[model samples]
Target chain A: MTRRKEKTELVPKEKQPISSQAGEPTRPGVFYSPAVDIFQTEEDLVIVADMPGVAPGDLNVDLEDSVLTVTGKVDEPDSDWKLRYREYGIGGYTRRFTLSDKIDQSGIEAKLVNGVLTVRLPKADALKPRKVLVKAA
Target chain B: MTVLRTHRFNDIWQEMNRWQQHMGDLFGERDYSKNACGVFPPINTYDNGESYIVLAEIPGISLDDLDITATATQLTLKGERSPNNDIADRSYHRAERDHGSFNRTIDLGQPIDPDKIDARFENGVLEIVLPRAAHALPRQITVKN
Candidate 1:
């Protein structure tokens, strides 16, 4: 049975603001916004984000009250040499997405590979289209 | 006296121009490097007295797809990031990732030993270490007692 494909809907930029959680201590330095790509398949919605310098152990993905958040902590390079020239600085990454009811929250999966994080949100079974047989009388 | 005064003014003017150029390189709309077509990967370079370390953010790229070449005073990185082919069946709601080929060249301002350079790619970041040439290393002569 071929299921109808649905287009993935990304949370609008205004709705994805960086919100501070209660009791979470604010760390000094900047938190950069990672570049992301959101797409949908027949079975799931996929999100890919670029977050370099973030190890798998340092990444956190949490879902609370329909809000999905991804955070990665990156430590500054430790070297004794003084910096003579710089083009970029090290920083952490934070991004959030509001999920819809169509997603199966329990079946969601995430993987980190080569500094890229891919999150798959499986569609609820009810949302999956079923092919029905027609009877000719 | 007039020649000296004009020379000093010219020196100050050149200094100001250099400062402006540096600022432009930092905050310009487009990269000042040869790879000006795309801005997928951003790089940072640092000099640590003995070697120059360069860090580039290039997520989603396989190590085999990346190329690096270094000379005494210059380094070049060339790579191509193929777009996700699995997403062909799905429609994109937000497509911000850029995929294409890019070549970036960096001038280290000091001579380095190409044979001593080392490169590593981890978690989507590429790091290159270029050690300064023996002649470029600072040397101190002992004072006679």
Candidate 2:
């Protein structure tokens, strides 16, 4: 028997000013496009993104005019230490997606845990598939 | 004199490794020998005089899924990222995140105090601080006027 993991509780979405344009630069510093995974379940569309070094308070998610944007800010490194070697660049993370009407904007939820952000966009009730029963005459 | 020479050699070797790693990054995800499905988790390392700070971007991983170990001159990180199985019923619109086991070993030329190392994970990032061995720390001498 396979055990299924229980769904995490959803938090109320926060309201923020949405940028007028999608993919437009809004914050300073090097902005890296974080790796993201989007998957659809029976009732929700889940998006998981990797954003290391981003704190909960520094993260912002906004949706406006069918565009969904995620941005994360990272603290600058200490000035006293000089960089002798570098394999990866430190910067903020930004990514945007154009959402469809099938998504229930009011029911959308997001959570950040352990450097990963998971956004759950619940599907509209009207878009869900329904089983039709045949009537025998 | 021999000990000093060995330390210098290690420094040079580490510098070369850094150059190679940077070149690999510049060329994009072509170094499949190390990680076949692209760099599962990219990392950055810094030296802060007294300790070495390493930060790795590994989001979606929980504490139970991560393992870190350090020797006097090397650090190893191993972890597994399980794939999302909840999406079996729906088609994917976009899938860029890679899932599987990952092991990355980093070589720090200067010896470090393994017992004194500190590590913390927050907001999808893992930060590690490795203090240099007592003998490896820089000492300032008083100047006679």
Candidate 3:
């Protein structure tokens, strides 16, 4: 999913708006909530978000007070093309998720590829399934 | 300065009708067909004076899984997505992403040079450049004084 550009100008028109037919202003200093899938296993919780047109270097992932935030800045393609129509807006992406106390924040790992961002959060030691010893009767 | 055509969904163009029909199959949102996509990769169309550029976003989809076809005035995209569950534990606590196949055809609203079309897929975004045909271009009228 692409970011939704606000109906304002984030970029100078330079006489470009005259050709726009998308019905919405797209200079897009706006940030959008990306579509995401969240899932968990016994050992780890994973999150995947769709942020097309965002490069890997433009992302920021930070954790504070057990809250995780992922932000991606989209680069407007440098071209002379004019917007004629659009099905999805274009801008940056930012979303946040709260991590449970059982999560090991330091062990979290994230990767972005083909415009998909995947984050893995490992479970704390206390939350892992453990084997118990029983005395033979 | 020449005023470029900026028509929205006000007029019913033949091309929009065919494109709307295809959109209705995957999304029954009626006129919203002129907008977003539910299961399909959302696309945007751009243009210069010479060609039409169609851009589609397909994150989490591998390039090898996509197939694109183009005509003189239309484009079709077909693809399948099977997300990689890279972790060891196969159990899923929650799943929101839908994975499967999608096929979409778009009417460009102008005849193009099908053979000269240039397509590039990078970073999960597919940009297709369809060059406008010679006859479809605006011809500058010369005055005979």
Candidate 4:
């Protein structure tokens, strides 16, 4: 039987861990599948991901061969602190996204604020809706 | 390292849970909460000599919208995440980030000064520092001859 958890909470969603995907990771640390929201408009496709404890400098967004990967490296907590109560583990975040040819790769832009990363991928010229002059018959 | 002692019910429960987790790890059991969802903005607690720090990961939330309350033994965190554009306006390919509001009450296990509890949001994590209550702190009495 598939283990499916009932959705009850309105705001707090559980963190999702990612199993190894494709190539091996160069850095040794725990990885999580960050919660993301993807919205597509007529002009652009926006991808927003939640990655807490990741500074702007620590975030990486790379797109190669139509495969876009987002990785956020988090700083490790001080080891001197003793763990008394535990709910989640300390680690980095990584998720892979496959983009289509319709997206303009050069137009991609992303920014991180308050632990949220938003990536804007503009639609290619061919994909954008063009208004053609209608010759009246 | 000296471990703080508290008689709260949550402390015992957490102790037992840690023990179970330790045993589970020994048996190579898969970690729970991995790929499984839990409460919003999962929290982890840590302790130093002077204070206990509670860290909660909250992404995309403004400090103005968040609320935090603390007592001698418990903490309450409340916040709301604003929704994006109207659902009808944009086509969402994937919507995994849950939104709305969340109120999480945490048991600190030890008595806190409450007045000294300091909380700040940085890099999307809500960090709450709960100092040990004065009465709970240990003091060495000098013996006069």
Candidate 5:
């Protein structure tokens, strides 16, 4: 028997649920529709995005005034159809997040390898754990 | 000696060469809009005794748009995704999907039995299975005293 997942997780259709009531909705030029998994280690935050059909040049990553945004676009394939069984339409992807002062914006990095977009944001010096040496009294 | 420290540093440095390259590329530019030029996905290859499997994630694409071709040593996937040309004059509250034309090609490291390849597409994922040549299989041997 063939088994399939009922529904894949999709980005929330509402752009910003919190900000919607505050003012007119922000028209985010680049929408990050890609599925991203965010993780943090002792020193940095890592964001892994699953952008299967997207290419390196097609990716746009921006860190501006404490906000991080990632955008991508993927094209469809060409095939002759006997009948329509399934449809996953083509659309652009957009994601945005407010940056924290503890992050080192200068050291943040992004890469597109193997259809995966990995963004690493290092923690700033002040945010890092420090060990103070005690002097003999 | 300083030479020893330099050598060790060089090993670590080279090990991180890809990381540095990627990091440099990441922070160098900031673009906020769609990219006019198109790019393709990278391919991965894995082999076992019976077959080799290739997997690619192709979201927001219809199965009809894809064209898969296999040769003795290569497998090619080509397709185009046309943007929503239908929607007009409505300001989108949010847009987070990518649409465009892309082609991905993977070179099977070893020669494969072209006639035995199998392919399946479902849920925006494409999988290609390539069987191994008969000679590539391992054979049993007897130990000598």
Candidate 6:
């Protein structure tokens, strides 16, 4: 009698968002959409976004109804030759964030230097870190 | 007098663009592309009772070409970058400078205290200070046990 091999089982995966021009879902690396890093501290949260090739004049940062949105565009640099290697290309970037009540929405701030966008969100008065004293019996 | 110089520079840059088209194609490597990786200047944010101070690094940009404005909650910066003229015919094995118009907007969560905001440009860096409204500051509280 010959031994028989058993078939392996396959798992079903969830559907993902597909690109408008292609039938397949978009992968993470192929395009550019600015990368953001957020750091939370006791007093505030700081967000840093990488938006190279963009000048301070072309960026738009807006905060409405506790939602923060950043929009900007970078024009293509002037050149006329065959491109052999490229790591960065000019493109548009837009991102939004819904803030929490603990934040002092009115006190949030943003700044752009070089090509980095920084946003600082301070905590509400009631949410700030405070030292509690123990009563002696 | 300051405005005239910048306007003239802008006219010249516009002419350069008109002389050529799709100049980016001349470069073979993408790293030297328009948006290639480069060290972005640091942004410093500071807060005082009345205002928030912001400083941005924008080297190679002339002060005359920059513009800064503030609204109740947003600060906008607009300016054009001109390529160095001294390097006339120097061919680049690699080029990373970004040339053209650029703008950056910053939102100070609090309403703009226009009367209190101060802006200045020096050495290619833009510094803006946004004052907080009296009512926008956090209030202190007393607790009883």
Best by DockQ: 4
lDDT over C-alpha atoms for residue B125 of model 2 = 72
On lDDT, the candidate that comes out on top is 4
Q: What tens digits encode model 2's per-residue C-alpha lDDT throughout A13-113?
A: 11112343545565656777777778778889888887778898999999999899899888877776655454456778888889999999999899888
Q: Model 4: runs farther than 4 Å from truth?
A: A1-8, A11-13, A21-23, A133-137, B1-37, B86-88, B141-145
Q: Could you tell me the lDDT of residue B74 within candidate 1? A: 90
Per-model chain A TM: 0.75, 0.76, 0.74, 0.83, 0.67, 0.66
Q: Note the DockQ of each predicted structure.
A: 0.33, 0.31, 0.28, 0.51, 0.03, 0.03
Model 6 per-residue lDDT tens digits across residues B1-145: 4555232556777877644434534653222323322323324455655567766545456668778888888877776655444423333322233445656666677775878888876434456778777778778988988
Q: State the weakest 10-residue window (summed lDDT) of model 3 chain B.
A: B30-39
Off by over 4 Å in 6: A1-31, A79-85, A131-137, B1-145
Residue A39, candidate 1: Cα error in Å is 0.5
Model 2, span B1-145: residue lDDT tens: 4555233556887988767888878976434333322444566678888999887777777789789999999999888777667456766767666567777788898999999999988777788999999999999999999
Q: Tell me how far the alpha carbon of residue B1 in candidate 2 is from the true structure, in angstroms, after superposition.
A: 23
| Tens-digit per-residue lDDT, B1-94, candidate 5 | 3555233555776868756766756995322111212334323344545777765566445668778888888888887644333323323322
Each candidate: fraction of true contacts kept?
Answer: 0.57, 0.58, 0.54, 0.76, 0.03, 0.07
Where is the poorest 10-residue window by lDDT in model 6 chain A? A8-17
Cα displacement (angstroms), candidate 5, residue B84, comes to: 34
Whole-model lDDT values for every prediction = 0.77, 0.75, 0.75, 0.82, 0.59, 0.57
Predicted candidate 5 versus true structure: per-residue lDDT over A23-83, tens digit per residue: 4435543333565556566777777666655667777899888999887665544322111
Q: Mind sharing the TM-score for model 6?
A: 0.37
- Cα-based RMSD of candidate 3: 11.9
lDDT of 1 by residue, B37-144 (tens): 234356767778788888888888888878899888899988777766755688788876666777778888989999999999898888888999999999999999
Q: What is the lDDT of residue B12 in candidate 5?
A: 75
Task: Give the per-residue Cα lDDT of candidate 1 at A27.
Answer: 67
Model 4, range B1-145, lDDT digits (tens) per residue? Answer: 9999664676887888878888988996646555325576678888887889988888888888788988799999887777654434677778887777778888777798999988888899888889999888778999999
